[model samples]
Target chain A: MALNQTLSVQRLDDPAPDSPIIEISHLQKVFAQRKKAPLEAVTDFSLDVRRGEVLGLIGPSGCGKTTILRMVAGLDSPSSGSIVVDGKEVTGPGPERAMVFQDFALLPWQSALENVVFGMAATKLSREERVARARAELARVGLSGFEDHLPKALSGGMKQRVGLARALAVNPTVLLLDEPFGALDAQTKTLLQDDMSATLQEEGCTTLLVTHDMSEAVYLCDRIVVLTNRPARISQAFSIDIPRPRGERFRSTPEFTELVDQVWQELKAHVTLSNSQAVVEG
Target chain B: MSSSIRTAWVAFATFLLLLAGWWGVAAIAPSSYLPTPLAIFERLVYFVVEGGLLDDLVSTMINIAAGFFIAAALGIASGLIMGVSRLGRDTIGFFVDVFQSAPSAALVPIIVVILGFGREAMITIVVIFCYFIIAVSTAAGARSIESGLHDMSATFGASRWLFFRKVLVPGSMPMIIVGLRLAMARAFNGGILAELLISIRGFGGKMMYFGGAFDFASLYALIAVALVLTFASMAVISLVGRQLIRWT
Candidate 1:
């Protein structure tokens, strides 16, 4: 549900800061399976993400938004292009970048607090300090009383919250979230999105989010990049000029509605095209 | 009744019925071929107190312990190595399959020949029989760890030792314990078979000697002792195993 409170659009200077923290140039990804034709997921895609700004990537199914995020996170190697973070190219998954997986990949054997602590295990921080930080991190995620619960005991939303806390606990220079709220019900998704957005901004984290939800992109991202279907290239990138410290009422604002409508309209064509192609092939 | 109580009563009923059937058959059968239940019980007590049965029990228990211990250690170590290393798996996997399929029981005569028909040879046979099963099971457990978890570990920059301790050991524990249970059972078979085949001075050798001498009551007593030993050992191992892996 969107809040109906309407107010005139108050101007804010440059919705996102001008300083860029992540630079992607002509990035391409292709995967091969046995006896199958090589699948080209992305090609010739490029974008710059500003420091302390959330960037959302939206596209049709199989459009390779997650592949781009993984390359940036250093979990997957780029086929032909480079992802430079703070001027250094990413070689592999490193301590400076942490990923919040779509699957909520918390280790099953670990308690929520232990999962967060595990994220910082490789750091040179003292064990006592890591434990304290993990406690604070879990508290920040609204899981203060449930710190001892294992992933099997938690609901999907709670597990995801733990995933977010784990990434945050690492104090990464870059945060990569792949469909962070995709598995949740709409109500839980909205609430978590709001809480997580506020916490992320408060921490001044540089985030790259991949989502299929157009409204979610409008709600959270400072900029949204839409990609074409497979062999994905950036079709458009829009800067969201909505004021910061957005409230529930902001969702009902004409500007927010307009942005959401625009993104949906832009994305609808890609979805329709993919579906029609699939039908034709079948 | 609660399931545990029901299970206990069912087992008790089964034992009572089996004992009654044995007693009935023994009453009709010749004393030389099938001793009466009361006679077997008396002989069992006599053997335990006066006929050197306790010494054989101690000897058999020691051999089984040495064989099982060496099997468990070597099996787990080699299994982990084969699981973690591609070269180790490739070089050793073929031999493991061959050894597992070969039926080590048939090799007793060959083993006695090479090792000179003694306690050492019997121990070697048990180790061989036990380790094959344990190694295969351990390797399967280690190798079956999900690839996603491995990727998670790598992404989190976990060191090799940390990954092994936090991921491999705990993840494979339940499977390893199951393998140990099965290996211990097989160790009993191997140890007893070796003693019987080589005529060693242990429980199996005593059973063979009593059987050849028309001492049916003593033979029946020896079998009952073996049955009790098997159940007792398995129960002990399973109880210890449950304590170790209560998480699963």
Candidate 2:
């Protein structure tokens, strides 16, 4: 944890270290169903993500963490409130933000390289430049020879690699990940986590990661925010004291386990409470 | 044996079995309505060589081609419109649903009455038979495009035109191809039905002439030729469709 102390001192030295790259304020979302009552998914959720930092949102499944990420991505408009990225207020999806989905939403009809190139469609780059960038991004994600493979041909982890490459190809200021590794097997998830940690360090892009995995949150995020069950609100926030560029060996370390355990304890209480309340209400 | 070789062997065996079965039935049956395989083969040779069957086959194919292409253009355009817009879906999609469910073959008589007993009437019946089915399938394909892909397009700030061109159109292509294949079969049926009902022309006319003269072997031969042609055309469509959606 000595690295945490050094980073805090360094943060004090910087002119505006506290300034946020993404500010989400009073975000609310209610899904209106045709024959059922409107379901409130998020209420008054607020957070500020510092530049070049990984911020993780962890909660029970279906707790509106994904809704918040979607709202930030501008794929779903908030019922009320605002999201400001960099300096501009986000009215809809803009060039500055890109989202990596849980399902690795590569177009089934497109090759891996083409899927990456698609992310840059809104950019001012020429066709040659776009193709060049797409190839480079695919190479960066260790998919050099697999560029022509469709999504169905690729493994789950490989598909996510394409998803990550696509998001990064756009050169976004903020990256939104919605449970990116939730679908992968355990071994693949660990391997991806290691690669992701290294990649995030290299890219140094501000990222908002929504995941229910406590260990993943502790490993990848600088800060973790836990939310209550449906109509999610911030229940707890924890800062991981570990240094960056965490490796596979870090997963066995005492600090890593300690942070994960702490997040789990906070998260477990909420999950239990929500489960009991649901039983009673039903 | 290799899979392809095994498949070829099975197909060859099946053809032989079918021919033997048909021969057995023709030997037992009293009426000339069931012709022997050898008789039908001889008649097919005569028609192809000297009886002007080739000219009638070419003309019928032209009608089917023209009608299918026209149906495809109208179907795809309207289907895409219905897919993307609520107004389009409610208005045009409603009518498509109604017409698609109705017996399209029954409408051939009405079309013949309106356009009269001509090539125009035949083409009209073919178009009517095909248009609704293609439109219905295309709309379904467009509507069923993955919602995640839409989100991906939006997140990257893609323009409406760009999304339509790159994502919506390509995503709906598999369904469009499905629609086209089905429409091709319907076009053939319509072309034949129109020839039978409106006027004695094309292969349908040849069949009527053979049946009247009690040339049962020639009728069976013409029917076999038409079946072979239909199968060949369908295979061509499937090949083109496979090429279009190679990713799937």
Candidate 3:
């Protein structure tokens, strides 16, 4: 254990090229809800996200999928374990990794264009360049004409697109999406999923998405990592060997159903285990 | 433009009707206290045409402006501190309670005695009176920011400075504007109160002077001017706040 800790620390400290984009080992998160006993949100989680790979984390509700994603994104800290992204240990948030939140956390005061430009401002980009780049990104996200519209005025899908544009504007090496399209209508979710898959493919940036939707995971992910409920640990990792440019037909194929069933089986056991724990605790 | 003109016409009509009613009541009663619209208007015109009403008005305006700006600067700074930090919240919370409950009239004698009867005393009184409202409201606004937004920004890899610059400022603006509007009304009242008690050169001072000499017409005219200033300031605050709401 000491040797692993030393290796993890060394791996994090060095900014070498060959290191995985994200490495997490024996990660745990405990939340203390004032006066109540601490709840173990996540536990003994371990995973590696290779550069340019799209990794999906799938689990039932309360399975700590979002917690894992947040920890990877450096939004929250692990109780124990090391998280190294791009060969650097993430102690706090840095611009190297950008996130698209579940609720589409766009600045309501800023227009879509302004929101995108805001993300780019922390970098060395000039104001004019930021504007131009922001415009291009908005156009890429199919928001060319609605540049001046505020987040409140935009539809859920549109708002999510703006969130995506804002994250992409930073030109980060890793993109962390916490159910970026979870709140949208089914049609909107499908459209956004396609856009997201295409965007990641085009950018070739490492992605780690947390989702409950099995189809979304199979469609977009290079590998889907299933987790056991509460004190979550990786139960299985399934590599999707499907060809790219997946359409509606791909979603209905036998291959897709088999993968979904496989994930669902792992998920069912975890759900049962969590329910029994709740009953016992109660 | 046309709709605004209609609004102006409606407002003017309402004012004329109110003035007519006041005149009719005064004429019917012929009391020693109340003055007619014509009498008040004559005094107002006389002051505008030949007297030092402008100078008196400007002096009072200057006092209010100076005191208001000073209070605003200090109040906003203190409010931001109180709003942003735990220590500031605890320390300022006690002062806010004391100031909010303290009577404006009660402080006039103390302020005049300490600072002496002059523009400095008047301005000082106004600043003290207005600071608490602005600061308290601003602190409330700052404290009301959603913790989730902070978490999201942090996770997105935004720095502490960036989070403050981007989220905190924009988030607090609505509340700050509310504070500003509330503070403006208090500031105006403080200015007038200070002049009534401590200064010899403002509209409020003029009102007291005319009232003491049994010059009811001029006193009423000065009162009207004060009302106009208060309403106009309120209007400006409302317009600015509306614009901010629209932007968000």
DockQ of every candidate structure? 0.45, 0.69, 0.32
TM-score of chain B of 2: 0.92
Superposed by TM-score, candidate 2 places the C-alpha of residue B51 at a distance from the truth, in angstroms, of 4.5
Pairs with backbone N, CA or C atoms under 3 Å apart (clashes), candidate 1: none
- Candidate of highest DockQ: 2
- Candidate 3 error regions (>4 Å): A1-19, A268-282, B1-30, B36-39, B152-165
The docking category that best describes candidate 1 is acceptable
Alpha carbon lDDT at B31, candidate 1: 58
Q: Identify the candidate with maximal lDDT.
A: 2
Pairs that clash in candidate 3: none
- Pairs in clash, predicted candidate 2: none
lDDT of 2 at A233: 91
List candidate 1 stretches off by more than 4 Å: A1-17, A249-258, A273-282, B1-42, B214-217
**Per-model TM-score on C-alpha atoms:** 0.88, 0.92, 0.85
> Which ten residues in a row are the worst by lDDT in model 2 chain B?
B104-113
Q: After superposition, how far is residue A261 of candidate 3 from its true place, in Å?
A: 4.1
Across residues A142-247, which tens digit of lDDT does each residue of candidate 2 receive?
9999989999999999999999999999999999999999999999999999999999999999999999999999889888888999989988877765678778
Candidate 1: chain B TM-score equals 0.91
